[model samples]
Target: MVSIVQTGVANRASVIAAFERCGVEATRAATAGDIEAAPFLVLPGVGSFGAGMEALRAAGLVDALRVRIEAGGPTLAICLGMQLLCASSEESPGVEGLGVIDAMVEALSQPARPRFGWNRVVPEFGCEVITEGFAYYANSFGVCERPAGWACAMSALEAPFVGAMRRGAVVACQFHPELSGPWGLKLLQRWMAMGVAAC
Candidate 1:
């Protein structure tokens, strides 16, 4: 399964190795194919919300992903990529997201700006449906969702930002699942086993 996405700031080798441990043949984001044929897609990011969306638009991946996932396909978004799944992001003043999930990506409510480094995504507030642990985080914005099964994993530092969420065919994670080692792979495999229709 190829990890289809935009830009390459995310370590592909690490992602490949992670997916391989889960019994998958991972590839880059640009393998060139449709939803049914490709099956799985991973969106990873490591930069500003506005800049990342611009890069995706420039590469014409925004619509491509929307179309794919809209048709009942499987997709995983990590870090900044998860931020782009919302309707809008505070990090980017006027930038638009895929709007797959009805939420907005807002910056953390901290004294300073640009929250970085690792945080503990403890399973509090019924956010345990997803992988729960001290996952590595490196993002500014997070999702505020309004769904029944809207699950979120959070760190100890901030206000428990949306660590991971799934709605229908879309899945997004605020943490670096690829960097979380085997635990990340296991969660990813669960998403893969869910298949396209399960979403």
Candidate 2:
């Protein structure tokens, strides 16, 4: 399966290596058609809401992604990538998203701002995740009121924000799994395994 590193912080190399380590053939997205052709597409980022959205729009990938998702292609969105899957973001008011999942990307409201470092990535309903440790996080925004059947990897920030959510073939996260090491790699493998089973 091929993956697209949508943004600069896409962690494209690490993801490719991780999938390769798992015996999966992964390729970087080179064009809009590349994204559409990809059986599995990845949207990763580590920037602000406005900047991230601008990048997608400038790249002309937003609508392409929507079309692919509508067609039922598997997609994995990490960090800001996951945020872009939502309809919109209050973090960057008026900035549009792919709207694949019924959710919104909002910022953390904390007196002590600039939250960082590894945080827990456990399932919202007590289900086990790739591991029981913190995943890498650089952003302060997360998805809210996620749709049912979507697994949430929540973190303890100003509130228990939605760190990750998975629905259908689309798996999204607010953390950087590539930087999270083996456990994160395993999660990608799990997604690939899910796609294989889906086929």
Candidate 3:
């Protein structure tokens, strides 16, 4: 089953609904025990890095998530959840991340405080599963470094920033797929398929 980690401050309900719409069974995991029992995991978030990370820690899910990933579990992280996977975020400096991806989250160079609309993203390499299209983003912070190859996807604001990233069984996106309409739903479907394949 796919477990959506309810950090208590994230948009867990919508994410769970999105997976269900894609014909995937998803459950909201309120505790570490629930998280540990899930085969596939989804970490959905909103707000600042420190708040998000602290919520996970308070829920006793930080270590559990690391353990799960170490075991090669399929995981998907959205929006702030994606940022939390990095080493640290400028939005919350000195706050260590889950360190799943050796990258840093930084404020968007764009003049806009929060990008709240549809934006086009292109696959840097030959990323087949994550198709290039217009996806909705609603954030002020983005991945500081650009994606090197197929392992990441790029989107434009003032310049290119990491929009989507993947490493092994883990895939993350800065945009809200649950609220991105059709394109987002398609992306989630592809991600769900990948999660199933990983399982």
Candidate 4:
């Protein structure tokens, strides 16, 4: 079963529906015990960096997430959820991220700070989850400093940002898989397949 960390900021119902549409059963996990009871975890987020982290802390999920991911638990973070995995973000200075991955989230360098549309992403460094296709994106901040080969996909929009990154069992995406149509669903399916294998 997939445990979705309930940050109370993301579209939790929509994400769960997406998973169900793909024939995957997912549960919303709010407490540490709920999080620990699942085989795999999905962290979804929206809004500013500070608010997201605050919600995670308020829900007392930070340490539980850290422990799970560090223990090699399969995880997928989406949008602001992915940004929260970084060490820090320029979106809200002085706010610390979960720091599971050594990277920083910064404002997109594109003309429009918040890019809103379908953008094409190409897989880099032989990433298994990232495939070349159009994925929906609506974000003001993204991981600009990709840790070399960890970048699963690269999007040229917003001055070539890290569209997706993966290390071991932890995977993150700046795009919303729940809203990216078929490509997004396929990506989630790939994630579930990987999660099943890891189990």
Candidate 5:
């Protein structure tokens, strides 16, 4: 089973559906306790940084997530969820992030804004969870600097950005693997298999 954090600003239905397609049972984590006890958790977001943080705070999940990630919990954070792992985002000045990663989310240098559709992700090192493939992305802001101690993958809108980063059992993706078609489904399957093996 996969417990998905209910941030209220996430693409919940699609995420759940994706997990279902993977033949994994996916449920919403309605409380912090649910998050704490989940074997495999997913933090997905599709909105502004401040709004996502506000929803997680309102749901009383901020501290729970911090503890989970700090302890190297099996987690997959996507898009805005990936940004929330940082210390802060330029998208929301004065708003603090989860601080799991010592980096900041910044606006993309490209003028096109929200670089939508598919882009290729090239892993910087040998990564078990990330591979070189075209993944779907829909964001205007991204982390430009790769955090130390994490395996990173890169993608470019105009300039390069951290497309995915993995450390221990936690994997964060700036692109939507769930929406990336067959390549993405395979990624999700691999992630789920890894979680099962960890158990």
Candidate 6:
């Protein structure tokens, strides 16, 4: 079963449906135990950074997630979930993130409006799952620089930003693969296959 962290700020239905389309069983993680013990895990979100962090903390999942990700458990973090993996986000000043990745989330510089639509993701050399493809995006903030020790993919609204970052069994995407059509489904399949191979 693929366990999805219930952050309360996520588009949970769509994410679960996406996994179902991949022929996988997806369920909400009810406790930290559910998170740590999930065979495959997904952290998905669709709201402000502070609210996401707040919900995680309120649910007592902050430490569980840290431990799980630190142990290199297979995890897929999407959209706001990706930003939550970083140290902080400009969208919610003074709110601490999971700090899994050494980076900060910043607002898109050029397009004042939230980047909402399909954008092509250009994967860096050595990216295992992500390829050059159009992925759906619906965010106002993202990581600008590639964090050290991560294989990153870039997408541009006007200036380039980190579209995805992968290290070990953890893959974080600024774009929502669940909403990206065929390319997204293929990406999900590839990621799931990678996790299964690791096991």
lDDT, candidates in the order shown: 0.68, 0.73, 0.80, 0.84, 0.89, 0.90
Model 4 C-alpha lDDT per residue in residues 1-199, reported as the tens digit of each score: 6788888658898899889989889887889887777777899988889999999999898898888877767889999999998899988899989988788887786443777989998887657677899989989888876765365788876378888987766789999989999899999988878777877
**Sort by lDDT, best first: what order?**
6, 5, 4, 3, 2, 1
Where's the lowest-lDDT run of ten residues in candidate 5?
108-117
Q: Per-residue lDDT for 1-199 in model 6, tens only? A: 7999998847898999998999999988979999989989999998899999999999999999999988888999999999999999889899999998999999896443477899989998767589899999999899999998889999887788999998877899999999999899999888888888877
How many clashes (backbone N, Cα, C below 3 Å) per candidate? 3, 1, 0, 0, 0, 0
Native-to-model Cα distance after best TM-score fit, residue 149 in candidate 4, in Å: 6.8
Q: What is residue 45's positional error in candidate 4, in angstroms?
A: 0.6
Residue 7, candidate 2: C-alpha displacement in angstroms: 2.2
Sorted by TM-score (best first), the order is 6, 5, 4, 3, 2, 1
Where is model 4 more than 4 Å wrong at Cα?
A: 110-112
Better of 2 and 4 by TM-score: 4
**Candidate 3: tens digits of C-alpha lDDT, residues 11-123:** 77788787788888887778878767877788899988999999988878888888876566778889999888777988888888998777888888544377799898777
Please list all clashing residue pairs in model 2, or write none if there are none.
119-134
- lDDT of candidate 6 at residue 108, scale 0 to 100: 90
Per lDDT, the best of the predicted structures is 6
Q: Candidate 5, clashing residue pairs? A: none
Candidate 6 shows a clash count of 0
Candidate 3: where is the Cα deviation over 4 Å? 110-112, 147-150
lDDT for 106 in candidate 5 is 93
Poorest 10 consecutive residues by lDDT, candidate 4 = 143-152
lDDT of 2 by residue, 1-199 (tens): 6576558665677767767777878777756888877888888776677888788788878778888776667878877788888888877888777777777766676432456788887675533444467788887667656555566766777567887776657778788777777778888877777777776
TM-score of each: 0.81, 0.85, 0.90, 0.93, 0.96, 0.96
Instruction: Give the 10-residue window scoring lowest on summed lDDT in candidate 2.
Output: 124-133
Q: RMSD of model 5, in Å? A: 1.3
How far does residue 70 in candidate 2 sit from its true spot (Å)? 3.2
